[model samples]
Target chain A: MDNHLFLPILMPLIGAALAVVAGQRRMLARTIVLLATLANLGYGTWLLWLVDAEGRQATQSGDWAAPFGITLVADGLSALMLIVAALLMLTTLIYSFATLDGDQERFFYYPLLLALLAGVSGAFITGDLFNLYVWFEVMLVASFGLLTLGGSRGQLEGGLKYVVLNLIGSTSFLIGAGLIYGVAGTLNMAHLGERLTTIQEPSLVTAIAGLFLFAFGAKAAIFPLFFWLPTSYHTPPVAVTAIFSGLMTKVGVYSLYRVFGLIFPNELARFAPLILTLAGLTMVIGVIGAVAQTDIRRILSFHIVSQIGYAIMGLGLASVAGLAAGILFIAHVMIVKTALFFIGGAAERIYGTAELKKMGGLAKREPLLATFWLIGILSLAGIPPLSGFFGKLALLQAGVAQQAWLITGVAAGVSILTLFSMLKIWNEVFWKKAYTDVSQLPRVPAGLMIPGAVLALASVALGLGAAPLADYSALAAGQAFDVSGYVVDVCGVAGCDAAATTVRQENTQ
Target chain B: MTLILSLVVGTLFAGAVYLMLRRSVVKLILGLILLSHGVNLLIFLMGDGLRRGEPAFVDSVTGAVSANAADPLIQALILTAIVISFGLITFIMSLAYRANQAVQSDDLDDMTLTDKL
Candidate 1:
């Protein structure tokens, strides 16, 4: 079963290659991507269960000992991310089947999507820091392609900003990895966990941690670094935007959690003030930005930034409960946010535009679209009996427990504003009278509507079944924080001892 | 050797930043390329300064590689980084070309089609 860890990463790559071979046969390529995504979901679920039952499983490539060879690990956190990623891939691909233009389907879109899936899953499970950087590049390259696929004026303009900023972020990550290697002599994360503690220069370690924070923080679209998101996200096809909205920044957030909690647990306290301050700013600023946006995807794009603030708030809380809440918040937002984009994409189709001023009276014509969209936005705003409420409540509870009053206040204020802004969309798009002639709007196909409804219902199920997921998130947090267990599981006791001895010898020399 | 290389890397970074802040998108891509080269060199310096004609093999008796030997891993890393950056820079160049055509201007300030409120 441990061997199956590579399957998630490999399946998509194989699918991508096959899709490339099936070039020009759009049907064949789509079928390949669909089958691959379905297989991945099955594998991801089985892997999650396997990990839950058997504890963290790690596999070293080439049978080389840990710290010397690249390792792929699947603890609770990775398995959970894997499951969510596969779910998003499948749902969005299904939505794209009906919505995506024929030109996009013919232009290696399927291959790029599979390649992106491969990259994201690779980033999630890789145990080496440099390997993570490599996976990030893979993801970025694919994203750069997807962002500018149609090469329209808006797409080219948006893609330039997205590419440059993300490239800089990836370079920062690479620098961080190189410096960590210089300091610890090993790029393997589990080994770094052991060796880093042995290093005497706390300040250097803090600097490296800060570098990582900036790197991952930029990718995650934290405050002061999120300009690329709102500018670029709405320019893509909604299907492209949906997958990116679900997975991209969250990968950055996940890395922050992994790096801070597992590798830099000692320095987390020192960074907490800065992290919490950024989180609060991110929340307020993101919501304020959302309120000012008139485009459907643009408003939702800004909300992605706002939602990331809550996830980071969990990280800043620096406790197991806080981390668990953050994890749950990410899961909840991924499903709900993608659902909203799907519904919004459908709405965009009806009016032939994404501008809210051009769209109105959608409720009367497509009641089902209005219903799914309402579920999406209501959950986004943290209303009761929805996923967002539970996610926000858990975060609030964690904050109150930690006595982080200022950030807690900021979070609460942001939630109200989130509701206000989402309601703004509701008022403009549904309740308001038609901005354009509603008589001539085309029917929104079931293909576009069904995927979103599935995810919206999933959000409801997530809320009603919050207890089990919370428990699982708590479990994942426990595994992430258990650095020694991680090290021992990856590197045998003797291997860890050898690494420790080398550190001692180097220090003395 | 370390000081000289560090200075070179610093210069590359400085030049890159200056170019990146310019109005021309082509200069920005050039800046990005320079920035990547600087980082690659920085990693090389981090791997430990130059060790001419040294082998990376471990001594059988000590079961450890000689400290004086060059780190082979750093070379592999730098190679990977170079290749990745090369691909990215190529893409960014094409993207700039497309954007330039679409907007009919090389000035970064003019490409505000997507940034409007």
Candidate 2:
């Protein structure tokens, strides 16, 4: 059963290679990508079920044992992340099938999408920090291809900022990995966790954690490092933007939760206050930034930054409940944000412009589209009976439990602004009368709206059925914080001692 | 020798940061290449400096390599880093060239087409 764990990482990789080989045959490429995504989704659900029943599993590649060879691990957290990723990949690929132009289809779009999947899935499964860095590069390279496609002046303009910032982010990430290896003498995460607990200096490990935070900070689009996100994210194709907003930044947040909770549990208190401060700032600034944007995609981009604050707030709360809430919030936001982007894309198809100033009458023209969009909007603004409300309530409750008054205030305030801005989009883009001649507007493609409409419906379903997801997240969080169990399971009994000796031997040599 | 090597790595990192901060897109790409070099070197040094030790394969009877020989895993990681960074650098160069072709400028400040409207 442990051996079956590599199948999730392998399937997308095989699928990607085939997709690239079938590049000229557009139908073959799309079909392969669709099948691969469906298979991955199935595999992810199975893996989650297995983990739920059996707990965490680990497998070292090449038949070598742990701490010696590369290991892949899957606990509830990884399984949950994988399923979320596969689900997004499937929905977005379906959306792209109908929406992407012939020009894009002829390009390497399908292959790049699969490659990004491989990278993302690989990052979640790898038990080694250095391997995680490698997977990050894989994702980055694929994104470069996806982002810069079309070569429009705006795309090139946005793509450059995205490229440069992310490259720096990768470099910082590499440096951090190096520092950790130098300190710990092993890059295997379980080994690192074991060694970290025994090490005398909390500050040293915390310092490395800070480096990771900065590196991932740029990726997650946290404040002071978030300029790259709003500047470039609006420039991508709506399908691309949907996937980007949905999965990419959350990967960074996930890593933060993993590394701090797994390898640096002793240092959480030192990091929590700072994380909380950043959380509050990230929320206020992100929402305010959204208010300033006139473009549909741009507003959503800023809100991505703000919603990230709630997830980070969960990290700050630093309790099992808090982390669970963070996990739930991240999952909730991923679907809502992607659905909103899809709706924007669908609306853009009809209105022929992304500028909210120029577009209106969508609600009058397409009430289904408007109503579908309202589920996402209402859910995002923390309304009751919606997914976002439970996410916020959990965070607010977690904050109260932790005595984090400032963040609780920020969360409350941000919800109001969030509703205000979302309503702004509702008024300007959907409900308001058309700005120009109404008959000149293009027809809303029913096919394109279907993907987002389904997702919007799913968001409501998720909201109504939020309890199971919250329970699942709490279970995942339990797995994350139980580092001793992880070290024992991944490395085997007393493998922690064996890993430490190995590190010592490496240093002396 | 270790001191000089580390100094070289530090110089590469410092210079890379300087180049990355420049307004020119090409300069930014060059900075990244240098930064990767610094990182790869840091990782290489992680395996430890030259020490008096024989290859573990000398003891072929037991099939267990001696601990004294440099562990090959860190080097393998470094090689992987080099290849990945090389690909990233090439991609960024092409992306910069494409940006230049599209916008007719290498200056990042001038590459703000989407932000102005």
Candidate 3:
């Protein structure tokens, strides 16, 4: 069962190679990619069940023991992320079938998409910090290709900012990994979990922690470091943008959860105020940016930043409930945001533009799409009996429990702004008089509408069935808080405590 | 040896930041290259400073690695980082070149088609 840990990462890589071999055979490539995603969905479900039934599961590569070889470990958190990612990948691929141009389809689109999935899965499962850096680069490289597939003027411009900023972020991550290895003399996360506690240099560890926070925070698009997200995310093809919106930033958030929650609990507590303040600013600024945007994708792009603040808020709270709320928020946002982009993308396709001024009265022409869009935004705005509402309620409840009144107030205010922004999109794009004759406009194909509907319904289902997910997130958060079980799972039953004692003795000597 | 390497790393980083702040897209790619080099050197320096020793190999006699050999792990890490950065730098170069051609200027300000409010 532990051996199956690598299956999720491996399948996409094999699929990518097969896709490359399929070459100009577009249908074959698409089928290959679809099969890989489905296989991963199966594997992810199984892994989640295994982790839930058992404790954390770990497999070290090539028979090497833990702390020496690369370790792939999936606790509840990793398994949940893997499953959500696979679901999004399948939905995005289906959406792409109708929206992606033949030019892109023929030009290694499926291959690159598979490669991106491989990277994302690897990042989720890897138990080594350096390996996480490698996975990030793999994802970034594939994304660079996808973002600029058509070589359009807007794409190149957007891709440049995306590439440069992310490269810097990756470099920052590399430095952080290198320095942590120097400080703790181990790169494996499980070992670091033990070793970091014994390390004597508190200030140095804190500084390194700051480096990591900046690196992952930049990638996650927190507050001031988020300019690249809105500028570049809106420029990609809607399918490309949709997948990125769903997976990429969440990976950064996941890293924060893994690193701070597991490895540097003390640092996380120390920096809680800073993290909370950043979260507040990110929410306020992001929603304001969204409210100011006229382009459909651009508006959605800014909302991504705003939504990320809520996830980080969960992290900043630093309790089991806080972490669970963060996890739930992440899961909720991943589905709802992607669904919005898919619906927004379809609207963009109908009028052949994303500018809100040019599109109106879509509700009358595409009532079903309008309905799906409403479900998406209402969920996004955290209205009652929706997944977003449960996610936000959990976060707000956690914040109040923690007595983080300022950030809690900020979060409440931001949701109203988020709703206002959604309504602005609604009024301009759906409810208003037609800017042009919509009778002549092409109807949205089933291919596009179905994916959005599926994900929107997923949000509804998640909301309706919130109990199980809430419990699951609590389990994941508990695992994250208690790193001892994780260490034992990865580093044999004897554990690293003996090794840690020896290191401490040597330092004293 | 550690001090000199640290100084070089600092200089490289400073240069990279300076170049990255320039308006030209070409300079941005150059900056990324310099920045990667700086990070590689920093990694190398962070590991046990300059050491003249045998390659990391286990002594069959003792069944343990020779204590004096430079850490092979750090070198392996550097190699991996270098290869990844090399590929990324090449990709960025091409991206910038194409972006330059598309926008008809190397200036970053001119490439605002996507972000214009």
Candidates 1 and 3 compared by DockQ, better number: 3
Residue pairs clashing in model 3 are none
**Among all candidates shown, the one with the greatest DockQ:** 3
State the fraction of real interface contacts model 1 keeps.
0.67
RMSD of each: 2.7, 2.4, 2.6
Question: What lDDT score is found at residue A417 in candidate 1?
Answer: 92
**Candidate ranking (DockQ, best to worst):** 3, 1, 2
* lDDT tens digits, residue span A386-487, model 3: 999999999999999989999999999999999999999899999999968989999889999999999999999999999999999999999988888888
Candidate 2: residue A98 lDDT (0-100): 82
Which sequence of candidate numbers ranks them by TM-score, best first? Answer: 3, 1, 2
For model 3 chain B, give the 10-residue run with minimal summed lDDT.
B58-67
In the order shown, the candidates' DockQ scores are: 0.56, 0.53, 0.59
Candidate 2 has an lDDT of 0.86
The alpha-carbon deviation from the true structure for residue A432 of candidate 1, after best TM-score superposition, in angstroms, is 1.7
* Residue-wise C-alpha lDDT for candidate 2, range B1-117, written one tens digit per residue: 668779999999999989989998888888888889998888877665444456435454544556578757667888998898888788878878888998888788898777864
Candidate 1: CAPRI quality band: medium
Off by over 4 Å in 3: A497-509
Q: Give the TM-score of candidate 2.
A: 0.96
Regions of candidate 2 where Cα sits further than 4 Å from its true position:
A437-440, A499-509, B52-58
- The list of candidate 1 runs beyond 4 A from truth reads A435-439, A494-509, B57-67
